[model samples]
Every structure is written in structure tokens, then in C-alpha cells.
Target chain A: MEAQGVDVVVLCGENNVAYATGHAAPSQEPARAGATRTVAILTRTDVRLLTPPPLDFDDGVRELAAAIGDHAGTLAIDEYPSMLVHAALAPHAPVDARPLLTAAKFVKMPAELDAMRRAQRINEQAMDDVLPALRPGIRDTDLSALFFRRIFELGATGNTVDPIWNVLPTSLADGPFTFTGHLPFPLPAVGRVLEKGDVIFNDAGIDFNGWASDFGRTWYVGVDPDARQRSQFRRYLEIVEACRAIIKPGASAWDVAIAAREANGGQPPWFPHLYVAHGIGTDSAELPFCGTDLGAEIESQVIFEPGTVLVLEPVVWDDGHGGYRAEEVIVVTDGGCELLTDYPHAPYE
Target chain B: MSKERVLDEMGRREVDVLILGREGNARAVSGAHRLFLAGERAFSPGCVVVAETGAVHVLSVTDFGVPADAHLYPPSWNPATLVGRVAALPGVRSAKRVGVDGITPLFEALLTAAVPDASLVDGEAIMRAARRIKSPDEVDHLRAAAAVARSTMAVALNGVARGLDDSGVVALAMEAMAAEGTTTAAFEPRISRAGQRVTVAVGVLRDGWEADVTRTAPEVDRPAELVAAIARCHPGVAVADVGADVHGVGCGYEALPADERLEPGMVLSVSVAGAGDTVLVTEDAPEVL
Candidate 1:
């Protein structure tokens, strides 16, 4: 943005807030009561931290003041406003801070890459315990509850997102009868049960040390999957692997996306249109979005440098059938890209 | 059982011999029992405990990392060298590699690796039936959360003004909540600008509307008459209809025409406009909690 002659940049989005300040209320849950909301003002040589009133008047402000003092200037602020108001006021700073930082975070730093890898390891462990617990009579909500309980017990704060529980039914009507259907439901109920031959899909993430690792896995309940279903699973895994294979330094996000599409028989999943890939860090979604029209190449000639973290997911869906997609976290490096998630992409038995 | 009876039933199902595993079953039962078990390490992916009578044997893959002694584990030599060890003490049995779902192919793998002869039982019915009603402690926490939300609204109303936008109101409310030590707002509050005047017909309109139309009759000197006029207006009447009838009346001309009904528990923002000036009235004078 500085090269483009833009002087100031203000960030108000939840993810942007996390990038600016270490403190961010989890997107999946409400903020703990009395936690301080923060706004950071970044200039060429100085950084100022602004906090909301009452919270700032208390000990939180003093702690923030001390933390920010090492950066440059004394913290200066107006009244701490809502996230929206803060975004509006963000650009008023002397220099644009968002574009600069966003470009920098496109590749993962070594520490961030390590965090993602650790998070994925924990996720795999949780899956090891969770997949077997799924049974014919288990309710979708009950399964989610178990996932939450186990993940938290394993030392994770919580799941990165609301665990998506989809139960394959004998017919489309039977499938849509679930509580949440498709409209993104919140909370869980105990009465919805799993039936025989149900193909259960769990699309969830794990938060380790404030970093997130998300992936999706499918399970066949009560009976073994059929030949066609098995083949579909293989194709899904192949698509994800194809994307990972070509994802290296000097590659474009579009190229990675296209590789996954081509591997899936030229018909990519709905996920590509929904969200192909994005940078991930403290906040779940970061910068450097991968889509058809992004135009930006992934080479060194581009602004994004090494040490940036990214999530690559290619989705495939059929209108009459259902949805299948696989996701993995990767870090841009000097040599190529490093895969953070090491779990096998095949369906859990 | 009725929805309220679920927790009681679960409490009754707790066994004296508890097994700590690395899975949800152990966590749920432990949380339900509130008993701290000592010494039992998470043996493998699955943990098991058998009661003295052997009537109830709980199998789970979730690990809580409780002590080894609180719950018994399988005994094995060279605990240090064991990649995955199964220990069976005097009264307890532990499994090293149990799958999460006891019915899947992985479950078979877990059973073969640990106790292949263990019987499969359905526990979902028992567990789901237990978490329905909110316990007293849960209720208390929810009430506390609601109070925080209400107080946050109070702060927003106090800070609202004509020039202030929606974002300003939201900030003020959040700031108040933060000051009060509440971490976040339960929901976003609604704020919008007041509209211009309109007309209303009698009979079709409510008593509050008639009272509003006639508000000019009451004055500071005539307290009784003002009270009488107020009495004529029903507490449940809609604020908009009332404002419409009194649009040209003394202070009524300045009233912002609002369409919301006055409910007993409602937190209202009562405003009146006159001579290009505005006045706001709130019940109990909303304050930052």
C-alpha cells in the first residue's frame, strides 16, 4: 500500500483485530466477560495501543501501556469504540499499517509453522479418539458434545469452529430433517441419533497456542462403505494431494486450485467457489485469498514473502449427492512450502 | 423420564469403581459424579474401569489425565519401556488402544490391540438422557450473563444522542460492559433515527393516543390533572399511536413517533420534540451497571 501511495489503513474485522493485537475473542465463542477490547495505531516508526474506557481505566490499560511502551511512542487513544467504529477510525493514522502487515503474514514464520503443525498433531489425536466413538445410535449433537469434551480435555481451548456433523440418510428428505439442515446452526441437541449405513462427516479444527489447524474427515457408521463411495473417497484424497504436490515457492494460488480441480475429473467441489484457500494464524482466516480472479501470482515477484501461513482446501459437491472437501495448512518457505498437517487424507475406518 | 429428571437418573447410575479413559464417556460421567479420581493415567486411546460387583464397566477413549490411584489401571512391568501398556490392578482393568466408536473397523482394531473379548454396550441413551436440564449452578451462571447484558444496554441508552450513529451506541455499550468487568455483549442493540409526524383517528386508536392528544391540558401547577391524564392512558398502549394523536398538543408535538408497545419489562427510550429541541425520558433512569 505504501508503494501504491496509500498513506493510512484501518483494520476493523475480527481477524484484522487479532493481527494488530494479540487479544482476540474467539469467533466460535463469546468473549469472557470483562476482557479488554484493543485497537493499535501503527505508524512508520511508532505503535500506539488504544483501549476501551472503564477497561482501560482499570488494570488492563496499564498492562497494555507497559507492553506497547517498548515499541516507540506513548500510547494515545480516544474512547475505545465498538469493532466497527474502531475500523472507521483506523485509517486516520499517519501511515498504512494493514496492507504492509498483511503482505508480510502471507507466508508463515517458523514459529507459526511449528504452531500449526502442533495443532494438527493434536487434531489427529482427537480424531483417533472421536472416530471410533461414532456409532449407529449416536446423535449428531451428542457427537459434537463429545468432540468438545475430548478436545478440551486434550489441552485445547476449544474446537476452531462449530464441528459440522452431517449424517447420510436413505434419502435427501431424511438427510435434511436434521436440526441445523444446511443453514449454519449454533449449539447442540442430544436427541438426534445416528442410524445404520450413515456416513458421518466431521469438519472441524483445533486451536493450539492461539493458532488453528482445520480439516475434515468422513466416517462410515454401522456398515462398510460401498465401492462407489470408496472410489469417491479416493478421488477426494487425490484432489487434496494434487494441490499439495504443486504448492511450492514461485507457484500461484490459482495453479494450486486448478491442480485440485483437474485431479477431481475437471469438476471441482463447491468449496472452490465457497473458499479455496486463505492465510491462517491467530485468527482463523488471514490474507492472500486463493480464488479464480485473485490475479496475484504466488512467486517471489509478488509482495507476499516467506514465513506466511496459508490453508488450502478444495471442495467438490454434486447437487443431488452431497459435499466432500479436504483442507490442510501450509507455510511458505525459501525452498518451497511445508505441510503443517500430517494426518492421512483418507476416510477414517 | 421427564426432561428435568435426566440429571438425577445419571447421578444414580454412577458406580463405585470408576475407570478413567482418554474419551467423552469418562469426562461426562466424571463431570456428572463430580468425584475426583486419583493415580489413573490415560492408558491408551481407550481407558476402562470395572466396579467391584462387575455390574457396570465403563469404556472410553477420551483422556482426562486424572491421577492413577483415583481409578485403577492394568498392572504391567517396565512401564517406562511400554509404547502402549494395558494394566489390570486388583479391581480395575485398563485398555491401551480402544477406538472411539466401538462399532467401527477401528473399534475392532482397538479391541484386538487391547481386550478383544470385552462386551459392547450402548451408553448413548444413558448419556443423552442425562444432560437435558440446567443444574442450579448452570442457572446461576446464565442469570449472571443476562444481568451483564441488561446493564450493557443501560450504558448504551445513556450515551445515545441525535448525532451519534449505530457504531457510537455500540461502542458506548461495550465500553460500559468492559468497565463493569463483563467481557462481551450478548447481542447487538438496535438504534435508529426518529421519524416525522403522522395522523391517527379516535376509537380506532387506543386510550394512550387520546391521552397524548390531550397532554397540553396537564401542567406542573396541576399535578393532579396530569396524573389523571396519565391514568387515562393504558400502560400497554403503543407509543406511536399515542404520539400521533398528540402531534400538535403542547409537549406532544415534540414526541418522537415510535411504534413499539410498552411492555412491563421493556427498557424504553421515551423522547419528545418541541420548538426544535428534544427531551428524553427513561424509566428508573438507565445507568451503567
Candidate 2:
């Protein structure tokens, strides 16, 4: 929000609320699905949090209030009882802090950056363990279980999201696509054994310490690759490499995306492409997305800032085959960007 | 023997033999020793006991198929075949099935088919009572799982910064965990914005269980003052009192205590929210595992 020049940020997302106020509650009712009605007000001189009764009435809130009281005056809140803030400040004059308090949290600080880094490290470890277990004859459900177990064993509080396993046969007509694109579905069974020539794609990520990391990779299950598969894989890799090549401190997101599109010769009926890359840090998806059509310029954009983290994915679809996508996480540095993933770009048998 | 003295009087009972089912029952009866028919069935539900002098016999009804040498048939199956088989077994005195409520209906049928005159026993409470104490191995697993959770938090904290979206942050965190060899997250990561505050929820499962542990870091402006207030939150003070004096709380985890007293053993996740910044504190040192 600070980077975007927006003040008095009003966040409705659960994770965002948690990030700003340090208090998050599980959705008590169904209507609150995908919504957590917690609010944090940050002003230059004071910070206030306004939340539903479920979250405010806790010892943690007491502790938070004490922490905030040391810093500023004139506690301002929306729904919280004004009396509570006033009573908390006995000797001091009660100041209404609504507008000014809401404007302060738009900027990012160093300590928040440190916390996010720790979250990323935990996520990377989960991916490392999951990649090797991708083989034939393993049930997707079992794989999911293994993934959960591994993440726990590795010391994460729990997964922030569901593990996704997609196995596609070399013959695209056979149809290995099984995801329903819904939540809470059971893991797929490993009923069919992996054949000698098959391509398996696994898209997975983890949530650690209230932060999240998501990445995708496609692997060759067996030794042989036909000409089409090889060509497709090569093109995908080329685009990924090209995307990374021009990602510098000053490069525009538009130019970076156009380079990828041009590399594909402006193929007709352009593959259903999402953003080439998105900012990642405290939340899983940030702003300043890399795409051709967005009116926002890439220069000095929020997404391209130094110290920003991003996920870069290049995708392509073949009529005979389903689709192929490869993604990686990169942290924008002063000079360029550093790739955080170790999944090999070369074909593996 | 008194009910409480059952373990002390194990050998004093008149019954010569004892039979138990698989898994839970097998463990209760033998304490880590494998039963004779361990490998025969997918789910174990059969136990047979042969008595001596003035003897007692025990049988389990969960058995689907058994050798001809066995004297009991599950009650639900045909009684005639069970009687004929029991009568044919050598030195079989009185054959009976152990009847227990809460047993699956299918097992009850098998027991009824095998033994017509079996004694029913209510052992559900006894079985449950036996499992309350944690074994040495169980404790070790719990501690190990907690350690794993702590370390994963470290990895997550490393990549967090301003401007990253929820999905991007979660993906990076997961990548860090994967790099450390974890294949899954414990729970769904919650990342969103609520009225100017950015929130991140790190949910990780530990030791085959999901702990809905959450941490919230509210973005704030005055870091120095927030830090001063947190520094004052020592043992034996009301957190609410502290908040009354401080301007705001930084970002971290929130716990609602049942009482006003803060004890040493109790774990509390503390968040100090400031403008654009948040800090997390816990009884455990702030370092990622």
C-alpha cells in the first residue's frame, strides 16, 4: 500500500489482517468464508486495531494494547467500544484516532521483512522433500499424506494450503487431469502405475508462520521423450530463462512479458496465460504483475522494487498435449534477481 | 481381584488362555508381542482362549476365516458350523464368545455364529482407561514434532517482507520448507488485508496432527515505543494494563488465557504491531529453530 501511494489501507483478507494487527481468528461462521473482519489502523503517531468481539476479547489483545499505549496518544477505533480505549488511558486525554491511525500501515519495515524470510525458508524445505517422492505407483492421496507428514517433521506449524499432484500421460488424449479446482477434495489415488514414458506435474506450496509460498514444476516420469515433448519443454525453459534475463532493477514488467510473448512468435490464440510473475513477500501474491495489457507501467512499479520477492512462471499449451508450466521464486536484488528454487531446468529421466 | 488391581492379578485368574484382536487389543493383551495370527487378515478381530481345570475361554468375533483347529466362530455367522467345529477340536471344554458392546455388527454376527453360549463383557471403558498414559516413545515423537514446527517457522520468517502478496509469501515459505525437505504444509496459510493491516497465518501439521496455531502481525508506525512496552511485559503483570499505557501492540500470535496470572510454563505468542511493521514474541526464544 505504501508503494502504491494508498493510505488508510482497509484490508479484508484474513492473512492481511493477521499481518497488520498480529491477531487472527478462525472463521466462526460460514458467511465469513474467505473473509476475516479484523482491521488494523496505523497512523504516523498511533496504531489501533479494530476487530470483532471474537478477536478483541482476549489476553493477547490486552498485551497488544499495552504495547501500543507506550507509543502514542488519542486512541482511535471504529467498532471497538471507545470507553475501552478511554478507560485504558486514565490520565491522558482521549483522542479519536480513526483517520490518522488507518493511514500509517501502508509502508513496510525491516522487522517484517525478517519474519517473511523465515517463512520462506520453511516453505522451500517442504518442496525439496516433495520432489524426490514423485514416482510411479504412488497414490496421490498417499503422496499428500507423505507431504503433510514431511512438512510437520520439518517443523512447520502446518500447511497453509492443500498439496496438488497432477499426473498426465504422454498421450494427452488419455486425460490425466483430475483436479476439480475446488477445496477440501480428497487426494487422488495412485491407482495407475507410472508408465515408462510419462510427464507428471506437481504444483505445491506451504504456509509457514502465517506466510505462504507457492511454486510449480513438471517432471519426466520415465526415460524417453518424443520430439513434441522435447520441443515444448525447450520452449518453456527458453521463456523462463528469457524472463529472468531482463529482470533488472530498472526493467519494466511490460517489456519482460513482451519478450516472452515474442519468443513464442505471438502464437495465435495465445495460451491462456496468467501473469508471468507476481510480487511475493508477506503475502503469497503482491502487485506490479508482469503482463502486457495492464495499464500500469513497469518502471518504478510496486512489484519491481528491490528486496521484493516474486514467482515467475512461463506456460504453453499444445493441441495434442494438455499444458506445461514451470515456475520459480526470485528475490529482486540491487543488480537483478536471485532464483530461490533448485528444481533442475534440464530434462530428467 | 479388584478392578484397579487387574494388572497385579493377571496370573491369578482361572482362565488358562487369553485371545485378543489386532492393533489396540493385541497391544493391550501382550504389550508389543505379536499374536499368532497376526499376518492372516487385513483387520484383526479374532481372539481365542482355551482354559484348563475349571477353565474360562475367550473368543473374538471379528475373524472372517480361521483354520479348522479353532473352536469358536463369530456369533453372526452360522452357529451350526461353529458348534460342529468347536466340538471337533481336541480337549475343548466349554466354548464361548466374548460379547462386548461397541463391537461392529459384522463382528457380532461372526461371534454369534461361532459360539451360542458366550459371556458378554463391557470392556470399552477398560480399554479407554488403559491408553491415557503416554509411553516413552510417544513423548519423544511429540517433542520431535514440535521441534520440526519451530524450525519451519524460522524458514518462513526469513523470506517475509513488505509488498509480497499472500500467495507469493506462502509460495516462498513453502519453497523454503521444501528446500529443507518438507513436502507438505500443516494447514492453509491465511494472507490478507483488513483495513490497512496485512495478515499472514502459518499453519503446519506436526506429528500427524494439525495444530491451528496462528500468528498475526499488524503493520504499525512507531517501532521504538512498541518495543519499549513489550520490554516491560514481564511475568506477573496484567497484559491489559500494559496495553492501557502503550500506544499499540505489534504483530505476533494471540492467546486468550483462562486466567489473569501469567505462569512460566504457559506459552503465549506476542505480537507488537506498529505502522508498517510487526514483531512476534513467545516464551520460546524468537530465533527460528
- Per-chain TM-score of chain A in candidate 2 equals 0.66
Q: Candidate 2, which segments miss by more than 4 Å at Cα?
A: A1-12, A21-38, A49-51, A54-118, A169-196, A222-227, A268-273, A292-303, A321-323, A346-349, B1-289
lDDT tens digits, residue span A1-349, model 1: 3454543333323344444555443322212111223455554444455554322122443444344344332222322212223223233332324445656556566676777777777777767676776778776655554554455445564344545565544333433222213312112222357787766555677666557777666677778767666766667778767866776667666666567668877765433223467767765665656653333354223333567666776655444554455667777677667777777744443
Question: Model 1, B1-289: lDDT tens per residue?
Answer: 1122322442455422232232334433332111111111112223343444332222211112232233423221222212133323333234222222112222323434445444333222333334222344433333344454445544554445333444455445444443443322222233444352111110100100001111111120223533332332344556554342221111001111244343322212122221010111123332111
Q: Give all TM-scores, in the order shown.
A: 0.47, 0.43
The sequence of per-residue lDDT tens digits that candidate 2 reaches over residues B114-201 is: 5556543433223323322233443343344445445554444443455555545555555544434333334345565676555554
lDDT of 2 at A304: 53
DockQ of each: 0.01, 0.01
Residue-wise C-alpha lDDT for candidate 2, range A147-233, written one tens digit per residue: 555555565544544455656533434542222111111123233345544566665555455555665766665455567777787
The docking category that best describes candidate 1 is incorrect
